[model samples]
Target: MPGRTRPIDKLAAAAAKCTKEGSVYGKCIMADYNNVHKDKCITEFLKLKECYLTAYKKR
Candidate 1:
């Protein structure tokens, strides 16, 4: 049997997908840890938040 996926893991996967898709802001925000918290990555942050909430509710 497979273990349950963590919320953080889901968020990481989403971020990885976003990074691969790329954005007008460039890959810096998606690829760099420091930039993850910056304004440029606000959209990505929201995506992660949504994933977290969904995962939390599922648990």
Candidate 2:
């Protein structure tokens, strides 16, 4: 596994690339952790998901 990239490493890289989106999504979730409802943060989550997908595809 010397030259092979680990799956976790790839994930970390993608997360780093999507930090802004992730932070926004995380904040939205934390804002209402007790009474979270469906689609409450769907917009933020979708943005984060798109960022991660784009980052992963670039690898």
Candidate 3:
């Protein structure tokens, strides 16, 4: 369950399973809300994608 788990699944389950796992899960509540589309992750990812698109357009 430690390092043996798949990285893809581990990342998806990170925010989803925090509550069932421990109290530190509470910390992610606001962060998770602030990032609604697909968690803080997808929001940040979209921002990066936008930047990449803009740069690519210049070239």
Candidate 4:
């Protein structure tokens, strides 16, 4: 199982969203989306502090 490759199907499902230009899995470019994502994609991107909920009465 060492040095194995990942299946493409698993990547497709794991992707949060894709470029709607019929290029769902088109280009694999390096991007500096750290800032752009949090600002432009605010509605979807979750803030770091917002993810912690230890004191909310555990289920």
Candidate 5:
């Protein structure tokens, strides 16, 4: 496992690849932080999730 990446590292890499989507999702949530409405950022969250999945698969 000399050159293998740890699971946490892979997760971080996938997250890094989806930073833009994550940021959008985060902003959407922060926009209504106190309100806590459901599905308000579903679109953004889905995009981030997809990006992370794709990135993780590619690794």
Candidate 6:
């Protein structure tokens, strides 16, 4: 799986990192499918979203 990748991989990897490093934003992103943490981490999520969008556009 060295070169393997997927759309959700970024988010999933951040979520895993959150588990180890205790990132509330990561937890919010990982579990807030319902937007419960929207107000709390909107800026962080937007940054992550921008990264995801940039990567998506490359492929």
> In terms of lDDT, which candidate is strongest?
2
**Model 6 over residues 1-59: C-alpha lDDT tens digits?**
68878748765654444333345457766775665633677776666666555555555
- Give me the displacement of residue 39 in model 1, in angstroms: 2.1
Which regions of candidate 4 deviate over 4 angstroms? Answer: 1-3, 7-9, 16-38, 47-59
lDDT of candidate 4 at residue 17, scale 0 to 100: 32
| TM-score of each candidate structure, all chains considered together | 0.38, 0.84, 0.33, 0.20, 0.82, 0.41
Index of the highest-TM-score prediction: 2
Query: Candidate 1 — which pairs collide?
Result: none
- Error of model 2, residue 17, in angstroms: 0.7
Candidate 5: segments with Cα more than 4 A from true spot: 1-4
Overlapping backbone residue pairs in candidate 2 total 0
Q: Which candidate would rank higher by lDDT, 2 or 6? A: 2
Candidate 6 vs. true structure, TM-score:
0.41
State the lDDT of candidate 1 residue by residue for 1-59, as single tens digits.
27988767766655555443345335546477564553767675566556555555554
- Model 3: CA > 4 A from native: 1-40
Model 6 misplacement above 4 A: 1-24, 27-37
Q: Higher-TM-score candidate among 3 and 5? A: 5
- lDDT (Cα, tens digit) per residue for candidate 2, span 1-59: 89999999999999899988999999999998999999999999999999999999998
Better of 3 and 6 by lDDT: 6
**For model 6, which pairs clash?**
none
Sorting all predicted structures by TM-score, with the top scorer first, yields 2, 5, 6, 1, 3, 4
Name the lDDT value of residue 7 in candidate 1: 65
Clashing pairs in 4: none
Question: Model 4: per-residue lDDT, tens digit, 1-59?
Answer: 56764555434433423223213212211144343432453332323212222212121
TM-score of 3: 0.33
Model 5 Cα lDDT, one tens digit per residue, 1-59: 89888999999989999889998999999987998877888899999999999999996
